[model samples]
Target: MDPLLAKIEYWILDCVENEYSYLWEIRSVIEQRLVDVDKAKLDEYLCMGLSSVLTQGYVQAFAGIDFRGEEQLVPGFSISTSFIEQHKKAWQAGVEVDQDIRFLISDTGFEHYRQGCPPEYFS
Candidate 1:
């Protein structure tokens, strides 16, 4: 794998796992510093980052995880609602989920973001 791709993957994994409080800002910085890269390649890598990684719904609230990136990272990246499939183990397991998801699963309206937008809004 390309080292730059690996580096992007690492940061993306971190964002997906725990989330970067300043995802868009840091990504902008990264993009600015990586001007030599092709835009298509960057987008491909960004999309790949999500497609290659498997995420748990209840455990991490993959669904409804709101990212406020208003095209700051990608040309048009804004998360209305990122939903993942429900996981039964999430309820039975003793581990605590992300605060955004731990108790919001049953909520009629997600505490953070519950927009009904499609996941491909960015794509």
Candidate 2:
């Protein structure tokens, strides 16, 4: 496997181990296709797809990062140094930017932010 793909696979596996359903969706979509993603395509998917995932509150479970309102900078995490660097490259490549990832939980058949979220997440 190409190194990029190997890293991506490792990261995706980490995502699944963390029980992040949204990220799992990303992996599932690619895996189902059974194809390799070049750097450009990967970057595009991360920027656009990740944004959508974040907007849908999938990032909360997977990212361990907190986002508040639109003004806030969503938090970022690192599963691996190489993976993180690859992610930045994808962003620099101008992947389609859309929704921001935020935190929300579904309960009682409703979607809401997780309770007791710190007023200042960065603190």
Candidate 3:
């Protein structure tokens, strides 16, 4: 994986692990960690990293979370290629996603992280 992508993935996974599932929270973590990287490049890399993980089924995106903190996952919500494309486009275009949308690491993602993010999965 590209170094920037790796860093993005690390921060993403970390945020999910820490219960910071909101997109803005994840972006904040990435921004704080990679302060040297300019905004445009950071947004680009963030879009790429997020799209890759979402398409790979490693991270699941939810439409919202209820008051009880349960995810309100719509059926087939994260399965469409267009969904990922739209997310990337919106992110790069500086359009804020719906505040309720959340990204959580799936079981496979947890396992992958446990295994230390093997290069094959990333590449």
Q: What's the lDDT for all of these models?
A: 0.35, 0.39, 0.66
Residue-pair clashes per prediction, in order, are 3, 1, 0
Please list the Cα RMSD from the true structure of every candidate, rounded to 1 decimal place.
16.7, 13.9, 5.8
Better of 1 and 3 by TM-score: 3
Given candidate 2, what's the lDDT at residue 24? 30
RMSD of candidate 1 to true structure, Å = 16.7
Question: Candidate 2: misplaced stretches above 4 Å?
Answer: 1-34, 61-123
lDDT score of residue 114 within candidate 2: 35
Where is model 3 poorest over a 10-residue stretch in terms of lDDT? 75-84
Which residue pairs of candidate 3 clash? none
How close is every model to the real structure, measured as TM-score?
Answer: 0.33, 0.30, 0.68
Candidate 2 lDDT over residue span 1-123, tens digit each = 344443333333334333333433554444444356565465444444344433443343323332232333345522333543554555569664344232232241122223322334212
Error of 1 at 76 (Å): 23
Specify the highest-TM-score model's number. Answer: 3
What TM-score does prediction 2 earn? 0.30
